[model samples]
Target: MDGTWLDHSRWPSAGRVLAAVSIMPALALAGWLLAGLPLLLLGWFRPLPMLLFGGALAVALCVYGARLEREDDAADATVWHVAATCGIAAASAVFNGIFHSEQLVIRRDPATYAQYAVWLADHGSLPIPYGTAAFGGPDPALVPSSVGVYDYGGAIVPQFMPGAPIVQAIGHWLGGVSGLLLVPPVLGGLAVLTVAGVVARLVGARWAPLAALAFAVALPVLYTSRTTFSEIPSLILIFGGIALALDTRARPRAAALAGLVFGLAVLVRIDGLRDVLPVLAYAGLLIALRRRQGRGERYARMGLPLLGGLAVGVGLGFLAAYSLARPYLSYLSDSVLPLLAICAVVLAATVAGAVLGPRIIPAGWKAMRGGRAARWLPGLAAGLVVLVTLGLAARPWVQTVHRVAKAEGDVLNAKFIVMTQLANGLPPDPSRLYYENSLYWVIWYVGVPVVVLATLAAAVLARRMALGRGFVWLLPLAIIGWTTVTTLWRPAITPDHPFASRRLVPVIVPGLILLAVWGLRWMWARARQAGYGPRVQRSLLAAGGALVLLPAVVTSIGTAFSPIERGESAQVAKLCEALPRDASVLIVERVTGERFTQVVRGMCRLPVAQVRPSGEAGAAAGANADINLAAPADVTRLAGRIRSAGRSPVVLAAQQAQLAPYGPATQVVKLRTRQDERSLVDPPNGTWSLTIDVWMAVPPTS
Candidate 1:
């Protein structure tokens, strides 16, 4: 149990490393089967049952893993620490994945993602057909709904980056519909492992597990990881990329791999470009500084490989987008060629600057290096001044952005404005949800002292970065800062619960946790220097750690144990099971219809279509449709059309009133519904006892 055993010099053997890696997936598989098998056997592979079973099993595995790690010897503790971290992450993901609403979380975003995955599983190609008749011609029933599908050149395509779908498709291929739900959790677990590895590199191995544990239960991390969201995958790649980049000095291939991974990140989410910007800047800085090496030699050793890998990765990304997502580009009224050209130009310019600019600015570089404070302080001051001046100058542009967002029916922005007005009783109030709520949420989980500690850690890290002691860590810090500012500046359009806080998970939570750990380590080091005995120092550290982690632990308990709102009502599942697979369904209400269409097509494996009320086609279709069942002629024609298609006609209405004209529905299903706006922090609102009526009618005497 020597302290030296925990040193970086004591690397684990390859067998141990492989064992550590293998244990996670094995545990994950065990957890998944334990959660899924009971429901599978009981014929209740639905949301509620799966969530309960999966959550319990995951929790048990995490607890047991932690206990086992606690009992391990220091000589082989590193492997156990890694296994425990991965186990906790995997367990959390399994629970979250199961606990996530069985239905798509956000109708537009996730539904499209699920559909894309489903299509990939089935067809394994581009240009997903909206329906059987989608490619033949324009059918009003087949028109792209806002719920993630887009109309593109007489074809229907998913309106999203394909990275997440491609990942989810693997799940679909493996486990069918339920498998898609597993993708995010698995990626989530990997992301946690990556974060732990990064922390171990930047800080120490001892701190890695704590950081990972903090992140595993973080509200944003837990919530987002459960859903079929793109952010999880993007985070995994970005974190992994950064971790590899940090190791570039020792392992140059790691830099190449990092660049390739980042390139794939952009392929997953266009916004990932923002995250990688700092890495690019850092690479340029490395090239320009040429630390302890000849300029051309340094470029060849570090710059060339990184750039080449970036070029290759980006080129592959463009190729994938153009080849696999052509329909999506067409829908956006854009072409991939222009984007590819632009990226190529950027890459070329970067290389050219790295190669030529250093020579041109040799004297400037020397001068800047000669006086650190004189150079940096002025530059920093000027940058701040420019930022302020730009903020003042761009007021009109900012207003225009808000105006445009509002016009585009941004619900979050509108809600923010309303909330601001209600809170302050003022006109033209900018939304401060991100700024205000971010701090509150952080405190809600990690407590106020940790926030202070994190701030102090940030200052310390900034100093270390300024001294060039830990320059590699700066890129990730920059990403954290940039994303935090931008996310708070413009939060996603979502209810305050999951979405608002969820966006901050990838960077903010991890950044804060890293800083807190650094602060704790700093305090412990100071305590040791002040002549505290080993026993006293250990006690103080343990007490301090408890204080730092207690709030988050308590909050996590409440969150983890809370009942998840079931996405699909039992009645809906019953209806799906009861209805014939080939039956043609005519949904009277637009919102209900579009939402259910995905469920029917993807989960139930049925063909479903919607019919808007005559004059209400465009407007009513946008929101909820008010179907006029009193218009017998319209109902008769729709029923006749359904019957003509060689399938039984089944009509579904959200309201009983909408079904009266059908002369007594064959079945009426009462459903418990809640307002879609929800958050993990808040308890569920009271359910609305709504009824869905289903009618089986003969062809209207055609």
Candidate 2:
């Protein structure tokens, strides 16, 4: 790499900057109004087609806007970055709105989100519900016994975090489902932006923006932003925590901040706690290890700030738990308090190890140093023995893994396999492989290569550190890797492997920044060594960052353009919106409109009617009696029920072709999709399709 290339020329001229800034605002305005304004217009009059047009035009405008006026001034480039990032996030949100009603059933753990949203709407200020089993409390008549009271309603539940839920709750209160749909991604976007800022500050200027750009374009981040999931927010806390840890100056304050961020991470997903353990444990270990060299006071001085942070963090955790899992906070002492106690014990142990290393462990020290297994056995056993002494130390984990595996297996065997057998056993779709395939592509495209270069950069930087300090500097990496490997092997890990990137994010994020800083210094040194021009070195470094980011950016954009099932809940939304406010709701399918509607209502605050059906409405029996009801019937039977009621009850029909038994009156509403648009693509053939059909009869007054 040419050394002179690394140095940037003076800012491309003020005229260029002014022109760039001017063009950006216009591009931004166009992008912002493209979908938003039309949707607003649709609300006033021409809704359906306007919404469709707005969406199509918005996508086009955004694609156009991103390409206009390309120059890379850090400040101006940052503006473009902000615009492009926002545009993609908004596009995902719009897609969410259009397709929300299609799924009929909540995907993944969105049910938990629904439960919390409903709790928030019913109560004021979050995570403050009574009893267990989500909104409306536990039903003794329905369940033999409460399996275990979980305060999923409060702060501890990631979905109901202070920032995310408060926003969604407002949305739920103001506009209902529409508000909820918009809320998650906005929070995700903010978190993403915050993470980007932290990343840029930690890494060199060149790498920071590019790293942020890669994340902005990444599919997983985009997907997380669009859905009511906590992954992105967890990402924010993890990165923030790591960045704080890397700051050498203000050690105590940084540690405290890191603790607070890690605490928030735990609130997002109980599993998220695993991500921060390496940093926290390693910091303590380092302090303890250094204590024998008469650095105990210095380590204590550094660790004191974190003590305040720990208190604040635990308080925040308790607050989060109380807010999200309010109904079950009392019982949280079992699940949460123990972990707090254990962490405290570890902190104390670290302090003790630091203060009394030689005196307290003289016997073990001799044995460990001598490699005498028998003499060292008690210390090792003592550590294990202490761990085991904690009540239910290992059983809870075993039980949880067993329960999840068994539940998933039974469902797959019974519902998937047996049902397929009854239906002539359809072959599995190949297209489904694309999900994991996309992930693999991204890992290779971005993660591995970045990691390799980063390691090289780290090695170069390590040469700058004095010998002892160099090894100590690398300690964080070892600790982080060990924690990551342990976490990945956990049985309950996310099935999405590339999501492992998110798991390693705390390390990767700060690590990259540190790498860039090192790489910059290394480039300077290399330039000096080769006697190359500073300008060339700077340019090469900048180019190096581009090399790392471009493939990721290109791959992500390419993946986004791939044909996917559009509007995951499109038909479901239509069904709900089409239904009269008074129409009784019935979901005959296992987890159809009834569950979706509950989530929708919980999310949106719409007063829908729930009703009981004529036959066994097994799956949706617990839906609201008037609007959230599930009516199980044949097409004719359903028609007869509608006729007998002498009014249309809102019906959501899935696999509408099966209702051929009913006469022509069983009209299914469908959007006329335009196939002529070259840019627009449909899901490739052989993909399993789920479509929702919303049906309503003509009002008598009309």
**How close is each model in CA RMSD to the real structure?**
9.1, 13.4
Alpha-carbon error at 575 in model 1, in Å? Answer: 3.3
Model 2 lDDT tens row, 1-702: 767665656335322232233222222222222333223223321234434653455455334423332242223334455555445435545543443321113433443454454445454432222322221222221111111113242312323333334334434555555565556556555544445444343343333445555555554454445545556555655554544444422344445644554555555555454455555555554455444444434333445455455445545545555544444334333444655666677667766765665455556656555766644454454343233223223333343232222433344433433333333334432111122222232244355445445556554434323222344344344434444334333323232322333443433343443454445555566777998787887787667667666655554454444323345345445554665554433333333443444443443334222223323443345553322223333323433444355444343434343222232234434532211011101111122333444333331221
The parts of candidate 1 lying over 4 Å away from their true place are 1-11, 14-77, 94-100, 104-108, 130-146, 289-292, 295-300, 316-352, 360-362, 372-408, 411-441, 567-573, 615-635, 667-701
- TM-score for candidate 2: 0.57
lDDT of each: 0.57, 0.41
- In candidate 2 the C-alpha lDDT for residue 673 amounts to 24
Local lDDT at 572 for model 2: 43
What is the Å distance of residue 271 in model 1 from its true position?
Answer: 1.9
